[model samples]
Target: MRRRLPAVLALPVAASVLALAAGPAAAQVETTPVPAPGNPGAPPASAPASPQPLGHAVGDAGTGLAVIRVLPNSTPTKAILPGAADKLPKQAAVELGFGLASAQANSEAYLAYEKSIAQASPGGIAVQGSSPQAPGSLAQTAPPNNEAPLTGGINPPSTPLDTLVKVGALNGSVSANWSDALGPCVDTISDASTSIASISALNAIPTLPGGKDLTGAFDAPNLDEAADNAVVEQLKNLAGPLSTLGGILGGQGSAGGGSVLSLPNTLSARSVVKLVDIPGSPNKAVQSTSTLQVAALKLLAGTPFEISINVVSQPTLQVTSTGDAATSAVQYTAPVLEVTQGGKSLGRLDAANPKLDIPISLPLPGADDLPGLGDLGKLPIVGNLLGDGSPLRDALSKDLQKLDLGVLRLAVAGLNQTGAAATQPFKGYQLGATARMVDLQVLPTEALGLPNLPSALAQVSLGEQVARAYAPEGGVVCGTASAPQAPPAPAPQGSATPQLAYTNAAYHSVPLFWTGTAMLLFGVVLVAALPTRRRKTTD
Candidate 1:
């Protein structure tokens, strides 16, 4: 029961981890959630203008941090035999495959450029195992350059950008993005922000004891983030007579009036543990224990010893001001551990009930005597010779005392226990952590009084992932004088000079209709008097 305290205490630790992993903060330092996107308040447009510029950019454009953690070979296995120094496999070949990085982009105009190359590098251990095997189970040959420069402004990736690598017993990708986390202050109207990270380990040797030889036995832990964006627009006011005349001339208002656009980003993230598929529990973490089977000795005859766990961590940030946010709280789900024996259940342990103690009786029946000694005390002649007064009967009985055959003990911590990072923007420093997801121990065959049992069937420890993420803090400044302003509104039509219609030669112009009538009459008279015999001959 005393061994269960760690399981009971995993709740609070898990809670903090979830809080750290919850998406980007909604607001940053000195910043409030802007009215949903383009909806600036009516007061900002009509209210008296402040002598000061809209907002000034302040502080450094904070740094970006990322990491992938795997325990070292020196770490002891979950289960240790009485005198054996079993250690994890050496991981000399595992190189930092673009999983670690630190980068910065200045929000100020003079320093407006970006810097990703100088900081990006391969970092942190990438695999967890405790076998004496040399060179470890994972290895990478000719790792590619881990750095990739950014285009489209100094914006960190708003979407996940990843570098992939694959080698013996290792395959996966690492990614991160902080698009607009530090917006350009060159203009006050363009605000955008988001910071997130993700990691996917698709294939690696299982961290569980006796898990190496089991075909298809592996662990995959993944982290992912999703972001929501809102766009905002700021427009300059159009007033005064000149502005009205421009409207009349079909021209946009004064030469420099227009709207500024901004996108404020929000995010949500989830940490996922994808391992063996557990029965009746979809998406939960699981490990297969097939390598510990000893069919000849009837030890763990249960062909498939499956251990399942439930753990999830989500971290959330609450923005306090522009370009600044901090982890506020976390959502925690109690962790649970369940074990299945040869198709049958041994028992389970969870936050609510943190105790799991079960005993397995020896498979051999009618074997009351020690394996090396016969039932000498029970023989009629021997019993008489080694009477109650003698030490032979008493000693023999004590040596044959029954021993528990095998037992299972398990402890599971929330995903938070796996790893965490703490940020100190003021100090420009970050701290990292590494922890275990699960701890499991099963009685070895030697514990069953079988000293000559093969080491394969003597697993002592089984556990899962450890991880971390980190970045130095930064500040943001909004540009004032150099910031671009909105363009003028277009001029309205139909205001041309009205006098042009009234200024015509004032009624002095001839009435063409009367003149045409007089001409027609004259022509008729001439034709009647001088040309009377025009068509008579033809008739």
Candidate 2:
């Protein structure tokens, strides 16, 4: 009983692993909940003829910020097991990188501008000043320049009176108009900067574990990834142009214009991180098994952690957009999800009613070489005696089981999915992120005495509509394969059947053990009874 204590104690660890695994898996979650602010009350239309201009570009503009989170576990987890998971490790791949950025509407007043870009291009602007550009004939009639030879102290012909008025009128008009417009333009720039900073601060915020304190400029998101994912589809369509622009502007996009147009620009955002120590809990009942250890640092999504993250994005109202006012809309499309193998789309995820399943794979350590089993086996009497019931095997199994490699790997996978980014409003300085979905599964080839494969995902909603999600054939979104596939049911003609997943649970063979016990008992009874007397015994 004493010898088996370790295994008995470790049994809970295994159960906890299963329980944790079976625990509901959370979906791709937004780390930052955009802070809800009482609007900084919209600036008055036009300040009473002041030197400074009014609200930025009064042609109708708005600002927004989305706060996503950084997965601090990304780097360390990757180091532990490389290529086993993807936190969307790379992007800026297509048009999809920039959008699916949901306009989370809080009040009815702000809903209208949720999807609208802050810088208004045009849909009939309201300008109160004269045209800064002079008209072709009367506006720009500069008298012809006459080159005349100059004598030592003599000058050429007297200036024409008509030319003087024309020049004076044009100059006066231009100077006055520009002066008035200058203030507003500067105000607009200031507004844009404030918006950028606010968004950046919101997206890359840090917090205590389990999101405690929540101290930041942003809020904890009640947002969904599906909705956000849906928004991304529109973005992917523009990948062609973005990729093209990158080429024209020179591929080094991380440094201002050098990489402004580049595709797949990586963004890392680490700052104000400190060495944290974590105490390990061996089990719920028996919590601290190890001493305090250094903890992993956290990073917020969309902030710059590396110099390479420098991207070129600038906001402007220089060019007015021309569009039909009749074409105004309040509708926006979201991204879709799909599963593909060899570039062939197998099926699509329902955007309206989205469901995502991620497989959490953990590489299990094999029983290849036992440290002392070989030496013990070589011993004379002990080797033969300890054949199948080796204590060493039992101890090793307990130790190996206690390590919980799978669970650790699962944590890493979750971290890899830590951060995600939206294309800044104007593709500004903070352009893209290296974040991606943590899809690589590290599965152990063999079972580690688990009762049933635990469900690896929490049932958290990723508060956004999605266009398409790429997944494996069986939509095991967040757990290891627990069972085998069952035979397909017959379906009606031409209709695609829903892809269903099935897993087999490990169970004890109660009936088989009972039946064997009964047989042995019967044989013992017969031997004791001695139905007939033996030949040597007198009958």
Candidate 3:
């Protein structure tokens, strides 16, 4: 209609315009980076003897945790950056460690040491008893397995931690292994050591006499100095706990097989616990900084660290009992233990994470939903994708796609961007948690070389409950538990003081006896030094 402006005429003009636009950039000469020549005198090098990290106490516990958390996934997120930020992925992580520790220099240990029981018992009773009413529940609830607190008094010990937690479902793990040594530590290098390269690395490391690696913690950026101090103290105080953890993880006492147990095993009641690795929507998060155990502390040797072999969770763990609870007059009960993961797909740490996301029904609820999802407006993801479809189908399609995290965000812009949309749920920046019942039984009856505290035991109780409750639904599977029935009441009344059912007494008892004897001698000296004759004359 407009005098046929030669359709072909536009091509030359466009080519000319493109050439002009690209001329300057194309005219520039290409340049390649020239690598500097290597010196022939430079000795052939491979790598450091100990591949070290430049870290924190538990900060190092993550093991390969840094590899997964430090890098941002290659995906689009709501908090996405414009340039380099987008190129480098973003993520966040928090650690929750449940350490069973005792005081470093416990005085009560002496009393328990010198004081003898009527019988010799080792290993607390496993908390398993038949529910008088239910047979299958026999393993579920048992009285014979019940164990009492190591320290007995009006007030029991409690854990020494202050905790904070949140929730999100993601792939994570719940592990238990004390013997597993932490990554090799450098004695010459402190957490503050700035010189990454060190020839003294090997000489810096001390020989592990106990076949255990005792080293300083990794250098971490966010960890506070006080927290580091606490970690060191925990290492010292909880040496016994660490060893116990090692044993449990190693399945030492179990005549059967292993100690690391997980839940929903879906297997026989008999078997060593396995590593339960599965994607769970716990959305559960927990954190702690407390390490004080009763009147004593358990930190020493910088901090505690351990390793792992990915294993499945075995619900049934073997409990080694020395004798009958009725005879010992001491019993124990199983406290609820759980692990979970959860998260709200919020944009970034700078913004609040999304808690609940409800997909919209079609009929075009709004422009935000699927294509022609509602009567509100056209989303046009595929250019009026459902231009001729039914509203019901549109709504159904929108909802179905949501099951996939990737589609959910696009279908609705409100979704949080922390999670990776891969097929696996655990593939995102989400939360992981562990829970255990903090009872005296869980604490080693024998302090080993460390001070034992009953107070700290109670403190960990809540943490265990929290970990156990870390469910996909974001609520405790088993609500807060009642006080454990362990260290049970005498099923048969006998006035004899129940003997302690613990091993390694002889090895750990020396220090206690030495301390007790020293006090006894001091008392004798004071009594003998008194002059009775002088007092009579003065009266």
Candidate 4:
């Protein structure tokens, strides 16, 4: 009986062992960050500012952005802000920062002036992580803080950063106010700024019943419990007859080991939030955008139950204001949900609804269908045990629980407040962009001929983002009540035409009129006298 145990129990032992090894290991988030797209810290490309006189330019704009990506079982790497001009200097367990009225000099004059008054004061903060729990990869920051040095041409920009942990999330972000007073009179001011952030695997899958965080993801313990609940005992009773069949199959009866879900090869979220205070004009404009792309969800590693899924989402907003009249436009998009069963497709689900319910069925082998157990049904005790309605089949059905396919959720929203001095009565309008994707309750399980197997072996999520951006009212402006005007140039010497000198004389029209009247009177008298003589002779 002892020698027969190993061979008889091989199938159950192997299945249970495979379930135990299906869980994913704790690993650092890996990322391949790319350069941010579109105009960073500037207005949208679709809309360009209209032409205006040089010194009359005036505008206020801002944006905020962030990014986080988690990759397991790979080398720890740094996450970069897509459009930032600089990179992180070094790796630290933990980094924290804070700042105040820090600004960069963007104009030639301001840059030169900054050199004269600029003293390196402690305007920013930095702290490194040293503790074991601190992975030295975590980072955090507040307003005015920067992950890298300023480009030295704008108001000190605010750039904050954070790291990904077990929950699989991190953030990279930047924002700033840039204003330059240039030209000889320093009357010209140009301003522009923006902000954004990105995240990965937004959150964790919820823990479910049966002490299984992920359904069939790591089922070693669950399988053991099921075995203890009479599964192994029932299998042993029938193993003696099926041993030959199990051997003929060459140990291929159990579902292959490993996770059920694949990692996101292309999970990413990007946002373009930028503002511009029109130079030489009271008009201001801003645009906000949020985009998310998730690679197909590939399931059922090393099995026929493998499948795939693709998700999509996007939101946008644009606004322009004349400081008294505001105008705006908005756009949004929804996604489609598709499910696949093994090599076959299950078609699409109702996208408007979030709940999902799908059933699975597989063909089972009959008593005579067993390769080595063809005549087993003809035996006495064994025939009864192997016949229809047997306890072994019941035990297998009772132990193989339903698979939890998990949920994928996406959300997006946009906000644009136009600046209107009359009704809105705000110096600066607020612009916001937000997008997020969440995956929860993922436990991939599928029924085989007997017990259950993981439906897929892949990573749960690709990446995530929480879009939050803003553009404040005022920036660097002159202290004067009204804008100063440029002085006129002096007249040149030795010009082509000489100027006429002023003369002290009576009004020309009055003098000429009186002289002409006196002459007329004298001439009339002489003509009358001479004409009288002539008229008398003619009469």
Model 3: how far residue 274 lies from native, Å = 21
Question: How many clashing pairs does model 1 include?
Answer: 50
In what order do the candidates fall by lDDT, top score first?
A: 4, 1, 3, 2
| Model 1 per-residue lDDT tens digits across residues 505-525 | 645456666788799999998
lDDT of 2 at 206: 16
lDDT of 4: 0.27
TM values, all candidates: 0.28, 0.18, 0.14, 0.34
- Which scores higher on TM-score, 1 or 3? 1
Mind giving the per-residue lDDT tens digits that candidate 3 earns over 269-318? Answer: 01111111122522111111111111110101111111111112211111
Query: Residue-wise lDDT of candidate 4 within 75-126, one digit each (tens)?
Result: 2224456634234333222222111111111211212222101111111221
Best by TM-score: 4
**Alpha carbon lDDT of residue 105, candidate 4?**
15
Between candidates 2 and 3, which one is better according to TM-score?
A: 2
Report model 1's TM-score to 2 decimal places: 0.28
Report the poorest 10 consecutive residues by lDDT, candidate 3.
192-201
lDDT of 3: 0.19
Top candidate, metric lDDT: 4
